[model samples]
Target: MDLPRDAQHDAVIVGGGHNGLVAAAYLARAGRSVLLLERLPATGGAAVSTRAFTGVDARLSRYSYLVSLLPRKIVDDLGLRFAVRRRGISSYTPHRDTGLLVDARDTARTREQFARLTGSERDFEAWQRFYAMTAHVARRVFPTLTEPLPTRAELERKVADPAAWEALFERPLGETVEAAFADDTVRGVVLTDALIGTFTHAHDPSLRQNRCFLYHVIGGGTGDWDVPIGGMGAFTDALADAARSAGARIVTGAEVTSIATDGRVAEVAYEDAATGRTHTVAARDVLVNASPHALAGLLGAPRPPRPEGAQLKVNMLLRRLPRLRDRAVDPADAFAGTFHVAEGYRQLQTAYEQAAAGRVPDAPPSEIYCHSLTDPSILSPELAATGAHTLTLFGLHAPARLFAADPEGTKRELLAATLAQLDAVLDEPLADCLATDADGRPCLEAKSPLDLEREVGLPGGHIFHRDLSWPYAQAPDAADAADEAGGPGTDVTQATGRWGVGTGCGNVFLCGAGAVRGGGVSGVPGHNAARAVLEKAR
Candidate 1:
């Protein structure tokens, strides 16, 4: 289990998450000696799919559900045999006895639904105009993510439209949402993107919500979140295959204990769980596919502030899709896309206030989506024939702080309350539709922020590894500007250059969600890190 005494490689990758796998594949394919170390028994990280219930044939996307920010370039570049199917219904939000369903196939019906929900077609018009502007921005900015860092001024100029730039990048997202949409439900739907896994309100001057919103909307240059054909696990599995086929050595259950470098060559020490023996591998470059906080600890440096995640994740196997209280909308259509519950604009604000005050929201704002409805490949033939389905719920404004006092007690209370909120919008209780496990227990599982931190190695369970950041650089001088200007060399003490993956150490780089433009299932940081090293070699 221990690496050879003189083991060495051109690149040593820490953490075998999707990003690490990506870096390995690219580096190895380029003919660089590559070794990737993963602490877990598997390499998917939080993006893996699992059958939570015993004796169940369903494999649910446990933590990260949907894919949006992952670029098509990564898919093609690696020759990954994976595909994503777009949801037919964008979203459905119920209020009282009625709902607003946005059917992608039927814009006329969607327009009609919007009018019924808001009592006017003006909001729909505004929605179209607002998204058109975002689409413009998406087309302009998304391509730059893989390129060298561009300064704020450069990105603004590239954006061209000053009005769009100012509305999205300069001002608070809540202000933009309120100015564009008059209907509370409509406003809430738009604002949910800004709040997903981010613990900030819409109007915060910090603009954290804006960053989240930008990433959500600019994905694939169209902002549509799609379902992976098999499951999230299949996507990462493809990455792993690509890495191995390209000659990257992947070691699972090998916990990286420390990393040391001198701006030239680096030494990585890992403990092989199988042998409980530590081994060291020397490499010309080190890619850290872990959170910044973890990277700091590994490098014996001061760690950043612990990130606080604000959400509750629940996965369930349903005997049958829950019927909606609004009978006019079919259960398949309602659950196929994002099903909003108690997420009206006012309700969202109130929930934020309650959570900020160290209490669970009276009615948690959450969204549910049925992966089975889109792709039944995760289900066995028997389960599929029985009309079984998988439902994943994301409860917002339930911060890590809320579970500090009593993790299990809080999770139990929060899950019940959140489901009750869903029940109010359903014809019957959600429990009525749950498929029992082989152990005769309800097929339900809930993960709080605390649980994510413990299991997934996410600091405070912050899903993005920390707060989401602007894809482009904010500084007046791009980090790599000097390099472009034929500067002497990369700053060894703070090595970040063009790709935003650079660690302070010259030979070390970040290739994970903590890197700029690096959240979600995107392999951008990994690709960028490899590019940086290859460029340096050139």
Candidate 2:
């Protein structure tokens, strides 16, 4: 897949991860000559699968693991062949002997469970109200993520209608959830989503941003959280296939050294990994899917500092499924879906405060997922027979600077601390179920925030391309700041923002979680970025 030096392309996409690949597919489909480059030996970035162990095949970043918000339009328009298996998520609090299950397409049953847990007639009623309101907001706002940011006047018109603004963004999600439920259990269950994949504390004022997070889970129309048939990576592979099928050239193992811009357009100067040859590709535009921190450094600039509350990610691989004490539930059902391990709001708050201080929380909040339950194909036959599972522990915030001192040692201590917290809830023998790679040492410590930061080139290893806070919101004004700061192009209002895929700098776009939509497995960024590029061309 080698193109000669001086080969000119309509667009050059840096990074062959899922979002970049998706962008490439859409642009190539539109008759644009697009070139995608990847520094890794293979593409997919975090949405990748590797044989970390001899007999085990699992996805990297497994727990940030599910994909439900991928726009239905992308699936149909791209003729994507991947199948998404629907297995709902569940939450368990071992100490209280309480749990909640989110089933597929049964809002009534879910409400009933809420009523039972809360023992109040208002529980079900509030649940319905909250769902309806959030669903409405998601419908209005989620579309904008794929579309380019609206004009200020247009935005004023959209939000100028008092009812529309209240329904979409003005109302606080945290306060709404709190008012909706009488029992702590029901509130806890709903509020857990606020902190799910993010580093935000559950009680933090910023948690309101997650108001629509759960609503987008409805998949724009499909009603459940869906995982690709083979595994998460299947979606990535399908995207790559789609890009290639559309005549886009993807070169993995090629790292761009610098962007040689002639003050008007950008050219990519890169080193080919296989041949160690230096090559340059001139293009009308360059799309970068690397993290903002990484992109800044690549431009020979100092790393942009992360905001005060930005969090770190710690991913792990476990050998066996977690054991919970609820005898009413079958042991097999435990692995059937995702689980939130935090006990309550107070605990969640404490953990967040600790992480903010650069110390691992004494009881860190974790959202655990066992992918083997939904996608058994991800596991080897031997591992499957033994009831082995691939577990992902997310939302553990460790400081990036601390790791800069002693990467390996600090990472090990962080893992040990997280395991100690897990020991408080699960009954499984931690030692017996711990995963070991081919080396026979614990595999849990392999992927840390530092590794992600180093690999993706984001400053502070901040997974969300831009912090999803006030100044970083994905609006038109936000795009200006991104431009000034050289932030990743994430203008959610723009159609081309998906992968930032296109021809000129402004002509090219970005989407996926890294774009304005921030972070998530949802393909909204890619879908939206594509539409922007195509619409502008037209």
Measured by lDDT, the strongest candidate is 1
Q: Per model, how many backbone clashes are there? A: 0, 30
Each model's lDDT comes to 0.89, 0.60
The digit string of per-residue lDDT tens for model 1 on 1-538 reads 6777577799999998888988999999999999999999999888898888898989988898789878899899999999999999999999999989989889899999998888999999998899999999999998998899888888999999999999999999999999999999999999999999998898999999999999999989888999999999999999999999999999999999998877677899999898899999999999998888888888877677889999999999999998888988999999999999999999999999999999989999999999999999999999999999999999999999999989999999999999999999898989999999999999999999999998888999899889988877755255555433322333322335678877657678889898888888888888999998898788
* lDDT of residue 287 for candidate 1: 92
lDDT at 435 for candidate 1? 94
Q: Which residue segments of model 1 deviate by more than 4 Å?
A: 476-495
TM-score of each: 0.97, 0.83
Error of 1 at 76 (Å): 1.1
